[model samples]
Each structure stands twice: as structure tokens, then as C-alpha cells.
Target: MNCYQKEDLIKMVEDAKQLTQKGKVADYIPALGEADPSTLAVAIYSGERECIYAGNIDEVFTLQSISKVLTLALALMDRGADYVFQRVGMEPTGDPFNSISKLESSVPSKPLNPMINAGALAVTDMLVGNTIEDKLERLLNFIRQLTGNDRITYNPVVAQSEFETADLNRSLCYFMRQHGIVESNVEQLINLYTKHCAIEMNCNDLAKLGFVIGNEGRDPNSDQNIIPLEIARIVKTFMVTCGMYNASGEFAIKVGIPAKSGVSGGILGSVPHGVGIGIYGPALDDKGNSIGGLRLLELIAKQSNLSIF
Candidate 1:
């Protein structure tokens, strides 16, 4: 019933694209810095296996922090909620995603939520693999299933860039290791974390991934569930509360969809049985979310009445 065409979304895309100038590309990660700040793209994947896209739809980008949500879902499936929640809290933090101030201040010393770097690292630590290569492959295979794309994999250049500049994340890992929230070699954990974050895909692939998440872990074309229903619910709940880094509260008020954003200017939105949206805009707000992508979602939510609230 919800078959959107490219013509239907072009206006919204163009309008949102103008905001690209208001934001800058994330430059701290050297490879991420190489992106063109003006590029903006989107794809909407419906339950019917239909897709509508606009802008630079072929551009491939790293998942960046967006991988956190997928990894969180995978972690929850591998380890039950009881086990996952014990390591990371459900509360959202007012601090930036990379900030470790809250970890030091909290009585029990755990990351506030899995959306943050510290918590993501802890969740990645829970992935069951005998070796680092196996762990990365497990995650990659899971992602390929989610997107229905057999060729999906990480960008080694981006992964290595992140690994080389992961001092802050390394520090967080060391601190968590001391607190027992993360029990593993810090170097190996960081390597795995970077690899997952560097997973690359275009807007179509991202939309497919989001569709699976929003569709309650069932693939659009499959009778079998890929992710458990309960696990999907928990992941969407976390997206609503903590997905947009420190800007989640404002984003929820405006868009009202469960969404997760990455520093690469990619946003994965699930409208809860409605549609899954993938957006890419290399220009990012101060909080590291895509400026054009956020505006585009706001427009789509308003026009389509897609808010869960």
C-alpha cells in the first residue's frame, strides 16, 4: 500500500539538501574527513520490497556509530537482556557520545547506554568468537543477512583510520576493563570495534537493514524471523531513547521515529511497521548526526504521519 516513487520524494530531498551547508563533515577520523560535505542521499524501503530513492543514492559510506544499534541487537540475541543490561545501563546521557565523564561519576561505573562508544565496546566484547577474525565475520554475516546483500563488508581504510586514532575509545576500554564491564584485551576489542564501525553500504542497503529492524526482525520476503521479536523491540526502544547521541531528545520531538545516526552522516529510521528510511549526508551537526538527513526525516514524518508517538 505504501509504494513511494522517486518523484514523490525529490522535493523533500532538495529542501533538506540545502541544510548541508549548515553542517560540516566529521574530520577527526581521517578517512571520514575525505567525504564531500554537500552530498545527500535517501532511500525508503517498504514492506512490499519496493524502494524509492533520491540524490546521490550510490554513495557508499561507513556505518560509523550506526553499527552500534545492529551490534546491540546481535548482542542481545547472543546474550539475553539480563546479561546485556548488566553491562550497560538503559538510561540516556546528556553528555556527548564519546565522553567518559558519566562513567567516572556513576556509582557502578558503566556506560549509560549502548549507543555510546563505551557501551558499544562493552557489547562488542560479548560477541562469542574464538578469534578476532571469526568475531568480525560473525558480525559481517549478520549484517549481510539484515541487508539481504551478500557482498557487504567493512572498509579497511576507514577501519584502519579509526583504529589508529582510537585513543579516546582505547582509554574508555581500559577504564571499562578495570571495572569488569569489559573483560578482554583492549587492543583486540578496539580492533573489532573499529572493523564493525567501518562496515560500508549504500542507501539502499541501509534502508533494507532498517526495514528488517522495523519489521520486527522479519525480512520482508521471508516467513522466518531473522532477529527474535523481543530483541527487535528492545533495539527499537533503545533507538527512541538514545540513538542520536546527545541530540536524541530533540530529534524524537521533531521526527517521532526510532532512528540511529552515524558520524558518517548516515541515519537509519524505522517508522514502526510503516517504512524503513536510509539517509546519507556527509555534513554533520555538532552532535555528529547528519543535518540534511535529520531534516529529510522530519519532512517525511510530517508528510506521512509516521510518528510512533
Candidate 2:
């Protein structure tokens, strides 16, 4: 099967919009709650010059959990896998992303994986910096390099909203502290996590980032290696197994590619040696995946035989 043509991809985008009603916008954060539920968009990149877009492709949204993938890669690069893995396990939790129960039940209390809230918080703590500002700048710069866009930035309003409503996350952080899993200042770590989650980008930016990962950590445009090949392989493995939160198993069985979803209704997908896909739809299913976005990916994967399985 061939890569999807621009016209056919646009049609797929249009057809997937009907699924918007099947999910609801993520409103618990208040900032994410403001997204227009009817909006849907997609962008695909195979090379620097080969790009396809459809729907509200220009609309900017927060990275949310999708940022975790980048942070995990950075942590792996900054600190080797052994050090990072010591604080966080590699297995999926089979629980909700924000579940506190898993933290309580685990014997040693290490976060199950870097994709969950607990694990991401611990990974965020590993980002070497003297202050939260320094750490955030490092993260944003890394993302800018990945997408080849220097203009990427954080959404302060969204960050503030999450901070104000972060009682549960605070609890998780303190729980980690209690168990010796995280030793950083709780407020500072939460602030950094929330701020990174608030980083804003459009489908095109995400597709470009995915493009680099799809090609095994090399920038397709500059032909430069961004992330080490080994690190990229580890990150992609985690994305395939744990990226979609508790719904990861179902998504793997259906989509059969490495992908990550955010509550902001964005999904980042990479088809090894094939293409990178970015999708945005603010309506979230019960499992916190973008309803329309997942539908679009299923259609594309099925039609193009994009599934790795």
C-alpha cells in the first residue's frame, strides 16, 4: 500500500469529524475545557517537502501528555536509561493515567511508566537544572529543535489553570516523596510538569516532531541526528506500549503503530520508515483519547496498511 494522497487524506479528515459527538472536551482543567469540540485537524509528513494537511490544521493546542515522550527522551539522553529507569518502571499500570491507587499498591512505589502522571512527574524531576525556569527552557529548546521551529512556546493561561486545580497531582507528588521515589520540591516539580504540558503547537509542528522520530531520531530536513538512535528506539517502544494511557492495549491492537495522545485532543503517531502523523480533535472519549483523531488514524492505518502488525 502507498502513503495516503493529500486529497484522500483530506476526505478522511472530513469523514472523521462525525465522531466528534462521540466524545467530550476535557473540561476538568478549565483551560482545556475551552477548546471548540467541533474542531478537527490532521497533518502528515514523510520528508521535508512532502507534507499533507486538512481541517483546522493551523489551530494551536497544548501538548499535554504528548510532551512526556520528549521529556523522557531528554531524560534518557541527559541521564542514561539505567538511572532514569531506577526511578520509574517500564511496565504499564492498567490503571487510569492519574490513579493514586497504583502508587499505594506498588511495593517500592516507583511510577509504573514514564507516560503516566506519576512517572512523568518523576521524569520531569530528572531534567537537570538549577531552577524550574532553567529546566523548562531546556525542555522547550529541545522541542524547538525536534520540530525545527524556534517559535514554539508555552501557554501560561493553561499552565496557571492546571496549577490552580492540581490538588490530585499534588497528592501524587507528595506520595512519591513519602516513598523516596522523588526528592525534589513538590511545588516546583508540579509547576514544571504543568508548564511543559501547556506547551502549545499545531498539527504541523507535531507531525514534524513525529517525522524525526519516524526516521529514528534523525532530522529529515537537515539530515542531522537529534536524539541518539538507541534513545529513540527506547522512546518509541514506550510510546507503542504505554502512550495511550490505559487504552494502550486497544489502540495497539487497532492502530498497530507507535503513538501518544494528550487530553488537549492531540495524538502523535509515527510509522517506522514510513510517515509521521499528527491529529487534533478536542473531544475526548471516556479513556481520555481524542475520539475523532483515533478514528482518523484507524482509517489511515487500515487503508494504507500502515499497521506494524
Q: Give the local distance difference test score of model 1.
A: 0.92
Worst 10 residues of 2 by lDDT: 1-10
lDDT of 1 by residue, 1-309 (tens): 155446768988999999999999989999999999999999999866657888988999999999999889988988899999999999999889999999999979999999999999999999989999998899999999988899999999999999999999999999999999999899999999999999999999999889889999999887569999999999999899999998999988999999999999999998778788999999999899999999999998998888898
Candidate 2 clashing pairs, residues 3+ apart or interchain: none
User: Against the unseen true structure, what C-alpha lDDT does each candidate score?
Assistant: 0.92, 0.92
Candidate 2 lDDT over residue span 184-275, tens digit each: 99998999999999999999999989988878999987889899999999999999999999999999999899999999999999888878
Models, CA RMSD each: 1.0, 1.2
Error of 2 at 218 (Å): 0.4
Relative to the unseen true structure, what is the C-alpha lDDT of residue 27 in candidate 2, on a scale of 0 to 100?
A: 99
Clashes of each: 0, 0
